[model samples]
Structures are given as structure tokens and as C-alpha cells.
Target: MANVTAKDAMQIHGRNPQHLVEKIIRTRIYDSRYWKEDCFALTAESLIDKAVELNYCGGIYGGNIKPTPFMCLLLKMLQIQPDKEIIVEFIKNEDYKYIRLLGSLYLRLTASSQDCYKYLEPLYDDFRCIRVKNRSGSLVRGHVDEFIDDLLHEDRVCDVILPRVQKRYILEETGEIQPRVSAIDDLLEDDEDTEKESDDELATSTRDQ
Candidate 1:
């Protein structure tokens, strides 16, 4: 891990970097009312139920579905900011195509170059079919390969803007890139404390008034 270099990552991934254009999907996501829902407080354990109940992890059959759950869930991921570990866990699970797709999308949006390549490169080989809505508002069948390819090469996929990744560079002295700090545990704690404090303050103010 510490000894791994950028060259090693590239050699392992073999995905030569390229500049890509941002897709129009971003606009569509923003325009959808359901995408604006607050999902920041959801936990890894809690999200599974919501994913299932919302019918987010299944295939779309018709064009009439409004406020598509998958897109809404993807937007929720951006808002909630699940850490790398949770995202990776989602990717590793073989149960649901939509869950894995969410993981891949989250990684592309937030992971470092090395982490992205390390986790998502393997998903390119996943041939599972996922039904998606196209620009013409028609339900279409698309495979995992198509989704992963667009995420790898295009700046935006499924209406999300991916941050530009810095080229992998190795310090000759360190011999490895530093791993990103994980904040999921801390985020849960902080959010809980913040909510409690807000509730207390609201009660106190209301009593005084």
C-alpha cells in the first residue's frame, strides 16, 4: 500500500487518462424535483431499506415512471456524502445492479484517482444489464460496461458532474500516495450532535417566547 506508486496504479489499471466533455445529464438531474430531497442523515444500514422500498434497485420497464428512484438515490448520495468504505461495500455487493451502479457513480464523483481505478476498474467487466431512461424519455436497456465506460471517460454521467481528477503523481521520497481520510464515522457523530443541539435550542427559544 505505502509502497504503491502512481505508475503502479496506472499499470494495474491500464486506463490511460484522457480529457472528456461534461454531459447534459447534469441539467436533467437538477430539474427533477425528487433529486432535491434531503438524504444527508441516512446511514449505511438505513439506506438499504429505502433503496428497496423505493424500487430503486430494479429495472425500469416503461417510460412513464416519474421521479425515478435510482436517479433520486444517486442525488442523495451526493448530498449525504457516504465515505469510501460504505461506497466500496456497496460496489462489492452482488445482490442489486442499482446498488452497485450507485457505488460506481459515487466513486466516480468523489474518489481519488487511485481509489477510483482500484475499485471501479473491475466493474467494467460486470456485464449485468441495467434499464435506464434516455434523453428521449424512453426506457432503454444498458449494460454495466456502458455505464462504467461513460464514468471513466466522460466528465458527467447520469446527470452528475465528476470532479476533475489530478494526475497521479508519486513523490520519490514517499514512494506512495497518501490514502484519503475516512470521515463516515465522524460524520454520523457530528450530525447526531448537531441535530440534538438544534432541538434543544429550538425548545429553549420557544419556551422563552
Candidate 2:
């Protein structure tokens, strides 16, 4: 098999480097056999590291095509918080056709996961608009339903979301989601500790009050 570089991956979807990295990382981790071994196993950490590295490279290259707002939209699909500002910004700033293309691809790729469907369900109106305008076929729709069914069978949601939420909150406080240079293991540990501390604090505060 050919080694899939970030560029090659992006070319597959006509996406930008950063978006390709993000998608590759997410998909690889999702398919990893030992992802449950740790919060950031070697394979998982490598993906995050690669994404940051590629993001930097793309910025420095200057001539590189930026990841489409559609890619960001897919990333946002994994988020629980209502990122209305980001979504609105993408709609206003991006080409409608590209946005629809990206959305269609995202739905097709993630359609086997029930959790993804749950996240996307709220955006039904937006999805419908894309479907109608883009003429995305029934095949993509089938994939979407399949993903939803898969999620229903697993009866589980992504374990990474809460920690990501915390990470996002911390980044929001700092006014940017800086890609940290720490090892994946360390990052995962820090997130675990944060979770523990949060639970402890919640319990303590609840009892105290």
C-alpha cells in the first residue's frame, strides 16, 4: 500500500493540507485497534503531531491552499458546544458549492457512526439545503443512515469529547487553540488529571454548598 501523506490524503478529497491531516488523524484513530490502550497512544499521538506540523508547514508555504471552511465544519461536527459563530463565519465566507461538497463528504464518511448522526441531526435544515443544492446522491444518504445504525448498535459515544471540550475551554481562555508541542502521552495525562480534578472539584463544591 502506498504511504498516505497529508497531501495525498487531501488530494483524495480536493481538500487543503490542514484539513487532510485532521481527517486522516481522526479516521486512523477511529479505526485503530489499540486506541483504548491510552488517551493518546503512539499511533494516535502521531496523528495529532502530524496535523500540527502540517498546519505550520502550510502556513509557512503561503502558496498552499488553505483548508476549506467545509473541513472546519467537519471538525466542528465532532464538537458538542454550539459553535454558531464559526458555522456562520464559514457560511458567509466560503463558497456555497464547496461547503456543500465538504458537508456531503463528511456525512458520507461519518455516516456509520450513530454518535455522528446525533451531532448532525440538529443541522438537518442545513444538511437539507446542501442535499438539494449539491444533488448529493442516495448513496451518500445510505452511508449516513448506516453510520447512525452503527452508533445505535454500539450504544457508546466518543470518549475523547469531554477532554477535547476541556481543552477547548482552556484554549478559549487563552484566546486561541494553540497546538501544543508536548508529547501525546503527556497531553493525554494532563487531560486525565484535568478530568479528575474537575470531578473532585464538582463533588467538593456540591457538598460544601
Candidate 3:
């Protein structure tokens, strides 16, 4: 019963939301001790405590294929199908990086292509460093923005196959979403302005001479 998705839960991506995680991975999560103990009877509201306690982000690890707390909570979120507003608040959370990551992953798995881009793209600016446990069970260094990029472009992340989403260019072409204006564009514009100023100064000096 613990592994079953909530009875009234709506379908996500045209199937059970938990199906977003592969069955094999989901089985391993069910067998995990964390799921048996910490995640027992967790409601959408109570899940916040577990999310806050997460120390790192990762999928399965080690020769035994152990599930990380991050993955455990991910499946639980799928099982419960928490309210979109609650998940949005999680995405907006600044206090806990893992909480933000949790929400971002949930959105990626369930939301439409446009909604995914709308929400996850902004997180590219979230540069906070996060530790990710690799398949070998060793903790590795990474940043939040790097993870977000993987979610946007990579086919798979943290051992889960992400649903295909439209490329930003495709969305822009269809006019479903506006063209992205990046921070780097602003920096390049500033550089051009500086160069123009330098050229004008050099020209005035030459004329005076």
C-alpha cells in the first residue's frame, strides 16, 4: 500500500506519475530503508520536513544500487502528487537548495514542455554549489545551474529518463513562448558600449593632434 500512488491522484504525462521513474528504480526505492521508515505515511505537508533534511542530490548508487534520499523523496512526491502550488513554492524556495531541486525535478517529469522551460530556465541563475552522489557512492561537487542545464538539454539525469521537451528555439519559432533574453547578452552589449566610447575618445585625440 505504501508504494501505491494516492487513490484520487490525477494522471500525469498520460500515465501514473510514479511511472516517470522506471519500474526497476521504483522497486529499489520501495526496498530502501528510508522509504520504509522516514517516508511512511508522509503527506504533502509533512514531506517538507523530509525534503529539508536532504543533504545531497543523486539517484541510485553503489554496487548494491542503493537509492539516495533525494530519489526517495522524488518517488514519494510522485506517489502523493502534491499540489502544483506547493511544488511551485518549493521551486521558489531559497532557503534549501535540495528542496528547490526536488520541485524542479518533479516539474520536469510531469509538466508540459512550455511549463518546464518557463520554470526550470530561471534556475539557471541559481549557482549554489550542491553535492551529488555518483554511481560509485562517492560524493561529487556540482552547482545548481549545471543540474538545471542537464534537465533542459540532457536526455537523462540522476539515472531517470526525462520526458522530451521542445527546444527553446522551437518554442520561440511557434511563438508559444517568448525568445529568451540571457544575462550574457547584457554583458556583451556593455562591452560594445565601452568599445564605442574608446573609439570616440581616440578619434577626438587624433583630430586635436
Q: Which candidate is the best by lDDT?
A: 3
Per-model TM against the reference = 0.56, 0.20, 0.96
Candidate 2 minimal-lDDT segment of 10 residues:
53-62
After the best TM-score superposition of candidate 2, give how far the Cα of residue 60 lies from its true spot, in angstroms. 34
Residue-pair clashes per candidate: 1, 4, 0
Clash pairs (backbone) in predicted model 1: 25-159
Against the true structure, candidate 3 has what lDDT? 0.93
Assess the local accuracy of residue 1 in candidate 3 as a C-alpha lDDT between 0 and 100. 79
lDDT (Cα, tens digit) per residue for candidate 2, span 56-118: 100001122232222333343333112334333323323343332333333433332232333
So what's the TM-score on candidate 3?
Answer: 0.96
Q: Show model 3 residue runs off by greater than 4 Å.
A: none
Sorted on lDDT, best first, the list reads: 3, 1, 2
Candidate 1, 6-107: lDDT as tens digits: 232221123321111122333344445554453334555667666655423321223433445676566455544555688888888888777888788767
Worst 10 residues of 3 by lDDT: 177-186
For candidate 2, what is the TM-score?
0.20
